[model samples]
Target: MTVDWDWSYTGDILPDLLKGLRYTIIATLAGYAIAIVLGMVWTLLRRTPFAAVNQAVRWITEFIRSTPLLVQLFFLYNVLPSWGLSLSSLTTGIIGLGLHYSTYTAEVYRAGIADVPRGQWEAATALNLPRSRVWLDVILPQAVRRVIPTLGNYLIAMFKDSPLLLAINVAELLHEAFEVGSKSLMFLEPITLVGLLFVAVSVPSSILVRRLERRYATY
Candidate 1:
């Protein structure tokens, strides 16, 4: 069988794909925001004086990192509503993506925080700086800056992973592509376009991340 490519069909499906891409972008940004903040929380919790708290947080982070994201997504999608906390598919997807990646981000944060010189903490202690002030003003500023490029890489990964939300019916880019192709009985155009669109976003993002790595190399 011969395959024919139709530019007009591609144009016709562009808007729907763009709509799905919008959801994909939104989910990625929201999820990544949560990951960054929650990951820091996990890192800080692990550093707490209470050994129990540290161990518990460490175990939780390990468990999350060890599990598959899709499994977590399904669990949240199914379990939450039964507990009277039903979330929209998109919201659930965001939360799943965030929670899964938070474990990875926490490791990144731990590395960045560890790289902060011991003298920095000693100096803060000598000044009698409040713990909160030391973390917020001295530690986090450095740690976050160092991890920004790595986090940007995760953002791109999360964007690519957004299509997995279709498993829970979130209607992201790949879902839209599937629908268009299924209805039109033509998979090539929609699938190829979806791939190109992914490249369109991720390539520029990767370039920016490389620039950030260079600009912050001295930090």
Candidate 2:
């Protein structure tokens, strides 16, 4: 079967595609904000001295990391309303993405923390620094700087995965492409555009991360 290519159709749907791109960016940024903060909390919780609490946190993080994100999204979108906690599709997508990615970010944080020199902790103790001050003033600053490239890579990954939000009708880039295809019967243009959009964003971001890694390696 010969497919008739439609250049005009691509032009017609450009606006809708751009609108979807906006939503994708919003979801990525908001979700990443939640992920970064919550990941730090999870890392801190897991590092506490209490064996049972730390173990529980480790187990939960592993569970979230190991499970499929689609299941988590469906659970957040469908199950929460039954408990009387309704959320808009966009909100649900953001929360689900945030929580799911937080597990990965927590692992990143844990690795960064573990990479810190043992002598630094001993020096902090010798200086009689409070635990909170030791972490905030000494540990976290260095740890966060070291992990920025990894976090940036995750941000790129999260941005690409934002299309999964369409499963719940969040209307991100790929969702808008589907809507355009459904109405106009021209799936190729919109779908191709979506792929290009992701590549355009992700490629440069990835290059930046690599550059950051190289620079950090120097110090």
Candidate 3:
């Protein structure tokens, strides 16, 4: 069966999709920043020498990782307001996405740190470097470089996942597609465009991440 394409409708819907695309990108970038920062904090906490702090961070991270993101999003959206806490849909969505992904990123960071040679730590100790100095000046830089590719992969994943914000009425790309399609009675073009846009962005990003990984590997 041949599929009919509607160029005119697609053209009419382009502006709305572009607006939504802006929000999607903004949310993705903001969420990624939060994830990276919070993930580092979580990783550091778990690696701390204090047994209680390490155990607490591990339990918290495991709980978050085990829970469904949708459930977490809905809980944040619906449950918090009853206790006098309220946030805009965009804010809630960004926070939820960031926190949810931070769990995964923390594990990535932990693996990276673990992969660092024990000799490096021993050398830091031999030098009488303070703990913070050792982490900042020596360990973190190397660990983060080793895990850059994995972290980049997560950013792409988070970008694609931003569409889930539409569930809470944050008008991201997919939400705008649905709105455009419902209003104009032309679902095919807008939906197809959204899918194409995601691929267009994600494929190139994945390639870039791979290239960076290869370049860093050579060093």
Candidate 4:
């Protein structure tokens, strides 16, 4: 079937799409913030000297990373309410995106931490620095900087995946586009606008990530 392109229709729906874009950006930032902190915690938690706790954390991170994010979202949005853990749609989406992606971030942080020189740890210990001081004042500064590009890439990914919040009724960009299309009885303009909007953001962000990765690689 041939579908006509309507520039006028697109212009009319632009405002609605922009509103959704705002929410998309907000969700991405919030989710990425959660991922950043939780990811670091996960990486550090697994390094505990306690074997049982360390093993349990490793298993949990692996489980979270291996599972599909959509399934996690569904469980958080639908199943949890049944267990008396009801959460609003936006809350669920933020938590779901944060947690699901945090496993990957943890791995990135792990790689970053591994990149730190072993001698640095020895020096810190020899100086009688607390482990927390070693990590905060020395190790993490280098590790987190090295992983900036990777984390930025994930933020772009989470921005794209913000559409999945539709499953739980959080009206992000894709959901907004769908709603506009349904109301106007014209899917082409709204859907195409959504695509264009995603490209507009993702392409530049990807370029930035590449630049960051190259800059970090030099160091």
For candidate 4, the 10 contiguous residues with the lowest summed lDDT are 210-219
lDDT of each: 0.93, 0.92, 0.93, 0.90
Candidate 1 per-residue lDDT over residues 1-219, each given as its tens digit: 987999999999999999999999999999999998999899989988999999999999999999889999999999999999988999999999999999999999999989888999999999999989999999888887888899889999999888999999998999999999999899999999999999999999999999999988744
Would you list the rank order by lDDT, best first? 1, 3, 2, 4
TM-scores of the models, in the order given = 0.93, 0.93, 0.94, 0.91
Clashes of 1: 0
Per-residue CA lDDT of candidate 3, range 122-206, in tens?
9999999998899999998888789999999999999999999999999999999999899878899999999999999999999
Candidate 1 residue runs with Cα over 4 Å from true position: 1-3, 125-133
lDDT of 3: 0.93
lDDT of 2 at 194: 89
Q: How do the residues 1-219 of candidate 4 rate in per-residue lDDT, one tens digit apiece? A: 987988888888889889888888888889999998999899889888999989999999999999888999998998889999978899899999999889989999999899898998899999999878998998988887888998899999999898998888887899899999999799988988899889999999999999999888726
Count clashing residue pairs in model 3. Answer: 0
Q: Quick one: RMSD of model 4?
A: 2.0
Regions of candidate 3 where Cα sits further than 4 Å from its true position: none
Worst 10 residues of 2 by lDDT: 210-219
